[model samples]
Target: MRRGIGLAAVLVIGCGGGSEPGGIVPLSEEPAYAVVLSDYTSTAIAMVRADGTAVDERWVTSGTETPGLVAALSGDVAIPSAGLGDGTLWLLDRFRTDVLTRIEVPSGEVLGQVRTHDAGEGESGWSSNPHDVALIADDLAWISRFEPNLDPAAPELERGNDLYAIDPSTMTRRGMRIGLSQYDVEVAGADGTSATAFARPSSIVRLGDVLVVGLARLTVAFDGAGPGAIAEVTIATGETRLIELEGLHDCARVVPAGERAIVGCAGFGDMAGKRATAGIAVVELVDGHVEITRTLRFGDDEQLPVASQGVVHVDADRVLAFEWGAFDPATPDRLFEIDLATGSAVEIASSAGPFELGSPLFDGAEDLALVPDASRGLRRFVRGEDGTWSEMDAIELATDLALPVRHIARL
Candidate 1:
């Protein structure tokens, strides 16, 4: 069940590794633009024109420093609001950002803000760490939690998951606590001695009726206890299945093509270990069973690890992947066009700086938006008719969200 596409051997493109002496192509393309919550101290959600111009920037004046952590662009609308999964749009007090502000999506009216009594131990905290949000149809919001509330020495608190069934029309929080569990890890690869590891809830994808979940795996020594296998939980039935692998870090949303899912595997540790595996791994979905298909690596140095952050299926034969800059700062953050047809990949374009790319989003309609790092914000790039690349000029949008802008979804 393992398809090995082998390697095309692309030379590792390091940061600041440029070919033309003139420097990055001057951005000329201008497209539609919009910014969400731009008035705040930091910018979070934004909409850009097909030509690279930012349309508008709206700064959700949530008093919290990191408002865009779970923000999204409402369906078919340019406004960036915090609502998804069951139609629950999130509203924070403009005066007090940490307060749970609720707002209805349909009419843009404010509902009562959520209030909480201190639960003592792991209950009340200074900050709210809402990891990922999934839109269930348009009624329920499935919000994941990864609270880094513990100091380095203190034992990590019992982390739980929340599923909010918000009334789309009223924007009220419903079905708040769905499930809770200990922090989990993902498996990327395994050898006889030790397996590579990843941490919990790195990425989540909704597939078919069930949500295919991917977490970071902590590849520990086989001799002792380590991360459990990667698992999937059924939202409807609450059934969980472990799709075991050896090492894993982050995973992009499932690409719906035929029945296969293309998962990007980064190297071993936080680039801490001496050895690592950098490539793209594939999983097949059949009869509700998850199976590993094939792993494709870019370029020759298999050791040069490709930390794929995002992937999208363009066609049966072609797919797009984002390669975060590895090891060297000069390594260009690369956009790889993978050809399953030849088991080969090509570097279509790259930002020479270490633009630590967040997950990539393809409107599929035309434009592409990529967030670099959790704190640095986002930069919009557009492809032109001539096939050359450039930045958008008209619409100026901010990418950094103070807190890391880890994920982005097209609503």
Candidate 2:
């Protein structure tokens, strides 16, 4: 699914007032703020206040060096960590350009940019295809490289399928690289030949000192997927342990839900058969041990559909999830509010077209949620006083860039 964009440097476009051209200006002081929108090939940002007023739709626009405020991102898959709460955002230009771009959300300053993969001279270079990043400290962070390096002679640090520690301040590799090759499992291929299930680490979340990472565990050829697994890495000691979920497959998205964490497993197969194995796993972090508390299968006498993505926690007992509409083109993608306690789902919204809904971004402070719709721009949903969600005005994207709205993140 990798494709090249040929981005080489950071790009900035000034849209807000009080700044020079190609520079970013800080939005007005508010307790809550903006949303960064990306359509894969290009990007645009909207600065919105806590009261739902948009300060600027074109807060940042396309430029010569970069797509927008950050490097061009991959829309092949929606990245979970679109924005970080610490006044910063780390944008991953995966697929072709394995670059990670960091930006200060408040100031719109490009703090640092680095290519995560080793680009050796000529034919020797390989792309690591970074997926998600988790900030460990002011100077420390961990990023998951999704693709495995097939070359046995590759350097241990350059070898994919592991979490690499980096200095968030410098955007450079730091400390020891945490290898995940040991978690790989062997499985039967479609032709009855045995294949290696590479531990394709994707989404990661930091829970205190333990980092919970989701493993896709797909075959090297990317044609088949094995059971999903979660790796818990100790922050201080760098110790790692793999917890395999027996029936879950292609489980790649992880999100923190209050004191617990939820893992969304998109089981492999065609739409009809995939739902039988697809589900969500509820995990709990007790003391320092990671444990699976419950597993909710999507199609087992439930309303939840297969291929759940963009899982967002809505307190300890509830979460907002998106269901892919690939089973039928006429079936629009849906946004569901799931009750973890009851294993029930309520369809909150549906896209206008199949597979048009991207990741959903929730702002707890404002009791608001933003769902990126390719056909309708950014759809806003507000929580009522009685604790119910209702659709509000869609955020206007008044830019000339004709890219479809696919992903959104908060500033």
Task: Give lDDT per model, in order.
Answer: 0.41, 0.72
Q: Write the per-residue lDDT of candidate 2 for residues 1-411, one digit (tens) a residue.
A: 111222335544323322345556655553244455566655555666655457666555444233233453343333336345767656676776787766566666666666776677531556788898887777787889998888878877788899987777667667458899998888887787999989999988777779899999999777777777899999899899989887778888887776788898888877765787788888888778798998887767545655368888877677888887754447788898888678888889998868788777777877888887888877889888887899998765654566566766554
Return the top candidate by lDDT: 2
For candidate 1, the C-alpha RMSD (Å) to the true structure equals 13.5
Candidate 2 — what's its lDDT? 0.72
RMSD of each: 13.5, 4.9
Tens digit of lDDT per residue, candidate 1, span 201-277?
A: 42445566665555444433422223323346576875667564444333423444445656555534444431244
Off by over 4 Å in 2: 1-22, 25-36, 50-53, 61-83, 122-125, 327-329, 385-387
Question: C-alpha displacement of 5 in model 2, angstroms?
Answer: 24
TM-score of 2: 0.86
lDDT of 1: 0.41
Q: Number of the top candidate by TM-score?
A: 2
